[model samples]
Target: MGVLGIFKKGLTKTRNFFSESFTKIAAGTGHFDDDMLDEFEETLVRADCGLPASSDIIDTVKASIRKTGNDSREAVMDVVRKRMLEILGDKTSFELEEGKLNILLMVGVNGTGKTTTAGKLAARYKKAGKKVIMAAADTFRAAAVEQLKSWGERTSTAVIAHPEGADPAAVVYDAVQAAKARKADLLIVDTAGRLHNKKNLMDELAKINRVINREAPDANIHSLLIIDATTGQNAVLQAQSFAEVAELDYIGITKLDGSAKGGVAIAVAYNSKLPIILAGLGESVEDLVDFDPIDFVNSLIE
Candidate 1:
């Protein structure tokens, strides 16, 4: 299937919810009336669009109706689509530097698929013919290093890790040396996700950044915040929190296929102002794809 098709399949639950719910709102009248507008707003919120975004969207559509005096279903939907695109901004893809070492720092609370995404990213970079190495810097979590090793094994990429309780920055130090020694093109680092103590987490990430900068000053670094879509509006909160904690370059939304809360993506982009560069559509390694705003909006709304 093509890229848009992949988004459609991944967002099946969300797409179906919007489709059926919107049709029900019309309910044989063939278009939305004032009475149906509240119900329409509820549909967006039910899909986890968040109250603020849903309100803005519905209010915009309502304004369009007032101005054009055309409340046809198609006209309303067109307005909805345009407003969503404005919220998402322009779609972006993950890009790598050709002549420099590119580092992807994966950050998020546990169970947000940060580690798995690290592995999947390594696989993608390797497929692109770049020599990729992974660093299991999430030493605080039990079995985190081992999980990364398994992905390294699966992807035929080298992983640098330390025992549990080891200093994560030390692991990054070693990983950078290995990347340099191996002349690798990309280094994907999986860091600890301990948001319970914000100061400690911030300190740990700072230390990791210091190591990377000292060890590979010329490397291009991209800190990606991985978010679980099923978490609903909490995902937006996480994005806001992480932006304060780290220099987040992009967002990677995971678990979109399993949740009807795909609207969380729009909510996140609207609130965070961080472009979503990756999406975890399914469980497989290959299920991770670049976030395409136009295609994503179409798949979810149409």
Candidate 2:
């Protein structure tokens, strides 16, 4: 499917919720009045845009209505889309420069699809004709290594892994060496998904990052926090917690198809000030697509 199709399909739940609420509000007084704005704000909050973002969106809408003296539903929605785009920002594209080892460190809590995202990312890079390697650094989990290895096999990418109970940093260290030796374009590291409160695990991630910096100083490193869209506001909390420990460069939201709270994407971007690089619309590797703010907002509110 095309990018728009993917967005439409993936955001079905969110679209339905937003559309229904917006239709009801628009159906009611054709004017962007106080009551209409109140309902619109409530809809945004209900869709998991978070309190702050919802308020900001409503304020923007009210300002637009006042400035232009136009309160039609279509005009108000156009203003809403513009505000959302501002919140989402324009840095949606994720690029891997040529001739540099691009290292993406995947971090998040368990059950957030960290491992799967790592694999899918590896596949994506490989399909783009880049030499890719995956590091199974989540040794704390019993089957983490095997699961990553499975993804490696599926994508025909190399996986660097150590035995269970091994130091996760050591796995990353090995992967860095492997990338250097193979002259790979990208090295995706899969770290154990530890709760944000776990100091030891967070420290381990730091250690791995230090290793990457020391071993591959020329590499372009990015720490991406993977989140589940269904978690709603909790996703924002996860981003905040990870931000305290890691230099999160981007966010990758998963399970967009499973929740009506995809508005959490906007909340996360606005609150964290981190660009959403990609979103997992479905289970397939190809389903992981780069985020497009215009397309996302249109899917949600159109």
Candidate 3:
């Protein structure tokens, strides 16, 4: 399918939620007034805009209406759209820098498809003539390491994994060194999908990062937080918490093919200020696509 066609499916679902909420708030016939503003604010907050951002958007819309005296529904919507984009900030584009090897660390809670997405990413880069190696850093789960190994065999890419309960950081350290020695094009680190005992999450991720940086200081290391699109507002909370722990550079939102309220993608991005780098639409290896903002916005409105 075409890019627009693929993205439209997701955008349509997200827009439906916002549009329905906005419709309820929109007046039958009146200039932008206090009641309309209150309604709009309520709608935004319900859509997972968060308190601060929701307030900012409402304020901007009110200011625009006051300045232009154009309080029609379309006018209000136009202002909302502009304010939304502005709140989203400069849309980020994620591309592996042209170089020998690019290392990416994938992290998230369980059931977020973290390992599956890593496998899919490796296959894509390998197909593009890049040597891809996956490091199963998720030592906490017995099945996670095995799952990544299965993906490695399927893609014909090498997977370096230690025993279950092994030190996750050591696995990453070894993987980085091996990738450098083998002249691999990319080293994808698959982290554990659990956040049990808060201290473990903070210490484990920090140690893993330190090990990788120590081995390959200049390696194009990118940390991606995988989030389940089906989680709705809860996904936003996960992003916020992960951002506090891991300095995440991008987001990989999965399960969009099944999620009815994909507005969580926008909520995550707006609240955390992290760019969404990839989206998973289906089970195929090619189901994941890079983030496209215009296509995303068009999908919502059209």
Candidate 4:
């Protein structure tokens, strides 16, 4: 399916919630009064849009209503849609450069689908005819290396790994050398999720980055911070902590299908000012898609 179709289908839960709540709020008059607007702002917060974003959007809606002298639901919703789009920033897609070793360093807290996302990306790049390799750099976590190796098996991609408790930077150094020797186009490194100790995690990432720089200085790299939409505002806070240390280039939002908290995307964007490069709309490998700002906002708030 096309990107628009994918977004529409994946955003079913959020769209349904939006429809139901707005229908209830606009029941008789089909227009918003002060009381209706107050309740609607609460609804946005409930949808996990975050306080700052919801407040900003509602302020925009109120100003538009005052300027147009139209309190109709159509007018209000249009204002909301446009404001949301603005909050998401410009539209962009994820793409690899030709004849370069592109590295996607997946980082996030535990249970945010970090390794699964790395596997899906390997599958996707391999299907696109790119030479892809997976690096199981999450050596500290139990079973993390095995899980990434399994993904490598499923995708027919080779995985470079070390024994658990091995230095993660050593894994990165070997992965970089292997990619160069094999002339691979992409290398996906799945790192451990240990946010409970931010300083240690940051130090580990720094060491791995040093290895990559020393080993493959010419490679194109993107540090992708994964966020679970199901976690709502908590995900936003976690992302902020990562932003302070990870030098993140993009965010990959996962688990959007499991809840109506899809507005977490908006919250993340507002807080981080970073582009969301990927969306995990479902459990299937094929369900992962590039985050299209226009399509996402249309499917969500309409």
Better of 1 and 3 by lDDT: 1
lDDT scores in order: 0.91, 0.90, 0.80, 0.90
- Model 2 per-residue lDDT tens digits across residues 184-242: 99999998877745798778888998999999998989889999999999999999988
Candidate 3 on 122-162: residue-level lDDT in tens?
99988888888999999988898999999999899899999
TM-score to native of every candidate shown: 0.97, 0.97, 0.90, 0.97
How many residue pairs collide in each prediction?
A: 0, 0, 0, 0
Q: For model 3, which pairs clash? A: none
Candidate 1 regions exceeding 4 Å error are none
Q: How far is candidate 3 from the true structure (C-alpha RMSD, Å)?
A: 2.2
Q: Model 1 over residues 1-302: C-alpha lDDT tens digits?
A: 98788889999999999999998888687788888989999999999988888899999999999999999898999999999999888988778888788899999988899988888888888898999999999998668988999999999999998999999999999999999898889999999888888899999999999999999999999899999999999999999888888999899999998999999998998899889989898877898889988999989877
TM-score of 2: 0.97
Model 4 residue runs over 4 Å out of place are none
Q: Give the number of the best model, judged by lDDT.
A: 1
How well does candidate 4 match the true structure in TM-score terms?
0.97
C-alpha lDDT of residue 35 in model 4: 91
